[model samples]
Target chain A: MKKINRRQLLQGMVTGAGCVAAASMFGSAAFAADTRIRHFWWGNPSRDERTYKVIDLFKNANPGFDVAGETIGWGDYWTKMATQTAGKNMADLVQMDYRFLFEYVHRGALLPLDEYFGKTLHLEDFDKSAIAGGMVDGKLYALNIGSNSQVMIYNKRLFAEAGIEFDPIKWNQAEQMDIAKKLSASTPKGVHGIDDATMNPIVWEAWTQQRGKTFYADGKVQAVAADLESFWEYWKEMRESGAAPSADVSVANLGFKMTESGIVTGATAMSQFWSNQIVGVQSLMKDEIGAAMLAHKKGGMPGQFIKPSMFMALTRDTKNPELATKYMNAWVNDPAQTAILGLERGVPASSKVRAALEPNLTVSEKVSVDYFNAIQSSVGPLPPPPPKGAGEVNAAFIRMGTNVILGRISIKDGAAEFIDEASSIVERAS
Target chain B: MRKFFVRNLPGYAFLTPWLLGFFLLALGPMLISLYLSFTKWDMVGDPQWVGLAQYEYMFLKDKRFWQSLDVTFTYVILAVPARLAFALMIAIVLDKGIRKIGIYRALYYLPSILGASIAIAILWREIFNIDGVVNAVLINFGIQGPNWIGNPDTSLYTLVVLAMWQFGSPMLIFLAGLRNIPTELYEAAEIDAASKAKQFFSITLPLLAPVLFFNIILQTIEAFKTFSSAFIISNGDGSPADSLLFFTIYLFNEAFTYFRMGYASALAWTLLIIIGLFTAVSFYTSKYWVYYENERD
Candidate 1:
């Protein structure tokens, strides 16, 4: 009798476990029928959480449509995207950067959104410049999420301590150097006045633009070697004068976040960041931080231009383009969604949405929005989207800058090498 | 054939999964990649047969290709021997009158399992950063440490140390090799008044040469294929003037970042050849040193 009881128990256990497995398998199958499209983007944890919330809102609003979101860290986003593109298995909705837009669009990996502008996407409220920034070869391959420009973000506490009256818009090349030197002289040991921008392509782009040349144009690097040489020489002098951190520290902090940035760490008085990044930086610091324009060149043209923070692109192979388009529309146009996403991507590219969110704006958001508004007339026209091989050229620019900063290569030689390498890359790419 | 299939049915069944995986996954991609090496494939477009152009570019024009090779070679030369030597030392020490050998062995082997993990690589980056724990400790001692991961001069060395830190597997193998040596041989040398150092040089080393040969080949191949540590350390761009640009990192960048898949494929094939040559060289050199127990004169 006991043996029979044991046999019954064993049978019951097996049946129960099998039923549970079968139920879960079928349960997921039912859920899978909800037209679930995959979305991919890169962001810090906070942005990821907010994005997921926005995705949830989209899902809730439209039953039977779902976006299964995937987020990789900033460092790994590109390599993963390339692999997915090669496999012809890209996510339906992808976050795109302007620098990378031309490459993807030219490869036909992106869907042209022009056909859907009136039919599915309602872009009436978006600023013309924001929409224009996403256009390539007359086809709208992406839609701008927001607009931003590079701004000089400084530690206000450090400036106040150094007794310098900082006016970022008026501070050109000479004033910046003088302030950097003054701050460096007054700061404690191990602290520098400015973070190094010697190797940053963004700064070089502005510098070259100020000199009436684009860093890259017409599918080639247009900046003259003499200009790059002067830029390097200027930065080199700054380093030598104890105005910036040593090359090693600068290299370490390259692409670092606020926590490790010289501005937040009190190792430097000033650094450059995108206008939208102020809130993120402030969140990580106890110090009072302020934003300013990247210093203009002495006797040079206006170089600053607002750029799309990022774009929402639909992959060419997406099985659910309409739903994806709807999701993207909600992302850029929905007031509630915009409120939640509020300048995380950047100040809203949609004028309607920006105006709607104005009444509920936090002080920090107002500051960024006001700054972008105030700088409108002063900034230059947006340059064309970087062409193919621009990624390699940008990397080479940084590397040559490092070589100059480290004293490994003379400024003249570095500039010459950069021009040769960048020209070849661009030529081959074209 | 029917009889053979019936007789070896269980064996074939056991091998089927791996066989299916090999043909479907590994072999298919490898074959495609080999074909791709001769083409100008941007991965998103049609692959154009450019026959030897990618190879020509890699060999003659790409400065980064040569730089990555130099970095990888330096890493392999330094890391493999240091790792093996450290493994051997620990194995010998553990072989001597040590207590709780099982626990000690497990403790020592933990890093080998964790070494290649992304978490560990991240931890390593933090440990070597300018404001990291190493510098924090150095500051306490009034010694300002160089930016280990930032400074190009010291970046590769930090990666080498990371490679050396995961010597547990080799150490375990060496321990087994040490145990297998006949106790009688060491006793005989001792009876003949051989000192410990002399005994180690003559009897122990000669017996250990085969083990050493095996380890050198394996570790050399491994060191060549190391990607994750360098990739994570350099943030995938091999920054700080490309000092940490390993061969694989360069290959990955060419293929993905630069959209030069065909060129990257050529680089992959070239690396395979280089590894093959190193293995062959090691085998050729082994004849002079390696001694088999069964092959006495």
Candidate 2:
């Protein structure tokens, strides 16, 4: 080999250094590009618009990261999520429902977030209870995005016309029945008094809780048979007295939103709904709509609680777990995002965010906040995740209730049949 | 050997795509499902071996299974025969001298093309709703009708009527069978002083037996798998006391809604066996009834 000159050596060193610098630049660029995170949520166009705006803000704040947002309707949400997770192709961040959080967590489909929150996320400023709702087996697998409590909504015009003083906070079953009857009696033809949904699990849970009983204990239904019997009996009497819609009408109304419900559509006076659904109900009503407490049983515990309405979770299959956590934290903590989201996902769980949004809140948002706050003290703990096969159980309740109303089965027989069927579903799932 | 392979490469190439599709798409999933039927799975956790338990639950314990079977059989019995008979009758009418034959044929075939679709099923619900056009027409005729879609007593019959109305495919098949019958034979029968009804029973019925059997088998299988109309109209609950609880609907609820994949797989196998048995019975009985002109005997 020939001897190398000092100039050639210096030149070689400079070229090597330049190449290393360029390679590092390209590597960092690829790392930034590969850091793209996807978040999946279930909502309508309004929610999608709000969520996309939030994602854009998140992207702006975290300049080195890319974010993608996906949304599906509520009905198809779980099916798509479950299919994707089972295939190990889940999105980085997901909007989860409490109803399915336990199932998903138990199946190891969710990544535990305790490490992420305490170490990586550093979300000490966030409300602890909002973070606690995601805990399972001493590990947090989700973070609460918002909260909600159920309420009874009534048509103010119809109530005033019927000369019924609707005070759900203090109303017992008898009082509710009386009001229902009076409203039905005084209302003009073609309008019903109440549009009750027997299939709503929230109603069933509330009924069970008012009796100081649990829907499930030791993985079995523990409520007294008479409690359920009485619930069916109350509705039966309502139907027979024409205080509620007929069986045919009730069946026809199944699966419809509150907006399409007879109560909001000027066909009935009252109905039970979530506080967040007030807008949907208000949109369909020609008159003012007001919220009231969930009607309680006489001398029974007010069985209601502000449950973590919805959660943002990281799927176990996520390729970028830390990035997903960062995105979720940003989405929940960001003030502007919370403002746009408002109380649609329910009231904001982050105290800071709620305080930030409260001053500029709309009338509807105020109504939701006031409704939830007013009932906050009276609300009971969230009932345990509904039993497996809960959908079938709910359907069975509707069918059995319809049978009773249609005189195909007696109320007593229908009650027994419904319990037996639902209990069997629980037992089979176990 | 290389020369031989290369010489037949085009033939093998032609078969390769179908073979690949079968192995990858159809056969692979089918085999997996077969294995899954013998295991307990929730589509989330790993499947556990529980051989025959799913089948045992389905055959021995599930009341819903029997209810679904009854509903499916009722639908098959009502829909398949009615559809075939109506199709044959229309085919006979169209075979006769008629004006605008093509228009009538197209008009009658429209429903069959749209029969198994979601939109048409939704339309069916609207047309049969409490205040739907059917009741409106009934009111015009000075008659009051009960809520057809809401009443359990009549909901299944409404579906039966809907199925009967979609006789287009079978009608076209019957029409083809009718046209295949030499016109000279009908003319000779007419010359022999045979009445139209007698000629139909003696000539058209015998000749159309093979096509009728084919239509019955196909329609019966379709009826057993009916889901969309029942699901949409019943709001996915098989409402009104499970009057419209078709087999596939129940199977789907079990698998997805309830997360009982093993049980659903077993139900699928049971349905397969039922269809197989029904088809076998039809083939066995066909010897006594169906006549093929090309039969050696």
TM-score of each: 0.92, 0.92
**Top lDDT hit:** 1
Q: Write the per-residue lDDT of candidate 2 for residues A69-158, one digit (tens) a residue.
A: 879888667766766765676777889888788888888888888777565575666667666777877888888888877778888888
DockQ of 1: 0.22
> Residue A56 in model 1: shift from native, Å?
2.4
Q: Interface RMSD computed for candidate 1 is what? A: 15.5
Instruction: Give per-residue CA lDDT, model 2, range B67-130, as digits (tens).
Output: 8888888888888888888888898889886999999999999998898889988898888877
Query: For each prediction, how big is the interface RMSD?
Result: 15.5, 25.3
lDDT of 2 at A226: 80
Among incorrect, acceptable, medium and high, the docking class of model 2 is: incorrect
- Which pairs, if any, clash in model 1? none
DockQ of candidate 2 relative to the true structure: 0.12
